[model samples]
Target: MTVANGSEPKDNGGVTPPGDVTPSETPDNRPSMSDLAAGYAGKAGLQRNSAGHVDMLKSAGGVQGIAESILPGLVFLVVFTFSRDLGPSLIAALAAAAIFTVVRLVQRRPLTQAVAGVVGVGISAWLANTTGKAEDFYVLGFFTNIAYIAALVVSIAIKWPVAGLLFGFVRNEGLDWRKDPERLRAYKLGTWIVVAVLALRLVVQVPLYFMGEAGLTALATTRLLMGAPLYILGLWVAWLVTKPAAQPSKPSSSAD
Candidate 1:
């Protein structure tokens, strides 16, 4: 027994391993699909929570979320407000919205995020179809107006957010979204365009409001609150306009 005990014990039975975690009893406290999706929808103002901090549209800050959700729509609003007819304005808006949608697709952004833009377009269209005369539509327009104002305020307050989002998408396209030297000259042009359109909107509104054509005035001031077809058109156009190049002009050589 003393000689046999000199060697170490060997040939023991194999041990079994633990099984994979199942959905019913997973140890990790990760969120489920609905919870994760709700978080994302909250970011874009597509959905809100019960206490409402979870959903942007439901939250006090949701209007900005909506505005940030669709950049081209705001730009389209600027364009539409100045146009003579709701029909053309709606067309233009739709054009711009379409482009924004395409850019999202090309960039491979989240599918749900892209669809949220579609929801805005639908609302715009319903308003256009009902026209400003409908009481319910006017109510909707009131809220939409609030959304625009809120967005405008947010864009100004957090000015870089929009540009950052844009350049982020552009960078994905393999183009350097940011300019070297970062001059504001290019952005100035868009600013001027918005100013001119805003003035035009005001100019048109004066006569329409005075003439007693309330719908026309609403069309001018609110940019066809009920005109969805035009919204789609505008979205398409915005996509087409394309961002101006970020490159600065190079100095010519004096050797010539």
Candidate 2:
């Protein structure tokens, strides 16, 4: 169900249930659940290249995006480790994020990721500065991981796994995969794979977080390592495991 650029998707012969309003027929023209799922999959940091292979780096937003995500925290960790000054460390981190935002603005590119980086850096700086504890900078990350784990668990419990919504759409299976028990089970497993990754972060970092100022460097380093890189690895593994089995090819007819 791959859709090419500037082309309409071919119908997969799906039928809308009776009394169900299509997107066009909706009063406010709000997108359907399927539409929302598709949009999420597109941004889930998983993409198939022209060769039909998953291009993890491209999906992770290329080299520039990866640097934008890591450098601010890296800057903070390095500066604070040497100077032991929260003020300068926070400024350096904020500057790193702000530089990315400025580059995006100057390049006339979409500001979504860059602006998000700036906002996240700003919050971490504020939390650490206000509490006068360098460790507080990572407090928000703990809550974020817990929230995602909870969401994924809930989705699996409801039998509409997050991985199904994400990977199913990316694979062009749409919501139809939910009707297949085998695929449904595979997606549930995939969702748990994601849950494990998020859980691993909390398990490893929370203890270091509790160590207070003394554990700042280890906590920061672990956070950077387990952040995007771990996520990509987990997602890749889940995707590979959940892939649909290939159908057996039919034999050709003999000449009459």
Candidate 3:
């Protein structure tokens, strides 16, 4: 028997196809993790463009968000450069973050970026204060990047790239994408790009930190330069790599 959409009708004993199950029946037809994953993957496979993925990236934080992210660090660096004092520098950074948060609140903008900026500044300041060294302010960032790089590497080593899983989760794209060799390859490449950026930050800043050459000013500068800017590039690279695979497959032409 043919279904209304021209597909063959199922021969099950009165059991409907999953999609045909009514919303009211969801409780009785609760999908398994594998089913959910398949649905997510199927959606991505059906997409005709990369717009959804782009929107997901924008929602996380766009260029303006990135600017907001680095503002507190920039303020700290400038203040420390002149005073060479940890206390004042910490206050300045925190104050800047507070002001940014207030501005965002006033504008009714998303608080995710502002809140995160403030938290990061607070952590760095606390580290510097506890350690009694101005250079220690950068410690949090260095280790954070190391952890990220390690996680990405391990995810890839396990044959499940962290970047891909995140992208899928964010976009509601399921594990089905992994079944496609091309899409999977694109995800792997994207993961590598992110790893490269994180590694670059550590490679440049770690030496300076240990050698005492970074000081407060140079370390701040390095952190600012490597922070949101490099991350944005990585985001772009991921988007670019996955764009092709996200495009819908073109219909094959019949013989003329």
Ordered from best to worst lDDT, the candidate numbers read: 2, 3, 1
Q: Where does the lowest 10-residue lDDT sum fall in candidate 3?
A: 1-10
- Using lDDT as the measure, name the better of candidate 2 and candidate 3: 2
lDDT tens per residue, model 2, 1-256: 2211222332212322223334554456655566556655665655666655566787677888899999999999999999999999999999999999999989997788899999988999999999999999889899989999998999999999988877775566778888899999999999999999999999999999999988988999999999889978998988898999999999999998
lDDT of each: 0.38, 0.81, 0.66
lDDT of 3 by residue, 25-110 (tens): 34654544434333433333222224344443343355667667777788777887888787998999899888888988899986
How far is 16's C-alpha from truth in model 3 (Å)? 22
Superposed Cα deviation of residue 159, candidate 3 (Å): 3.2
Our tally of clashes for model 3 stands at: 2
User: Could you arrange the candidates by TM-score from highest to lowest?
Assistant: 2, 3, 1
What stretches of model 1 exceed 4 Å from their correct place?
1-22, 26-73, 132-256
> Candidate 2 — which residues are off by over 4 angstroms?
1-22, 25-30
TM-score of each: 0.32, 0.87, 0.71
TM-score leader: 2
RMSD of 3: 9.1
Relative to the true structure, candidate 3 reaches a TM of: 0.71
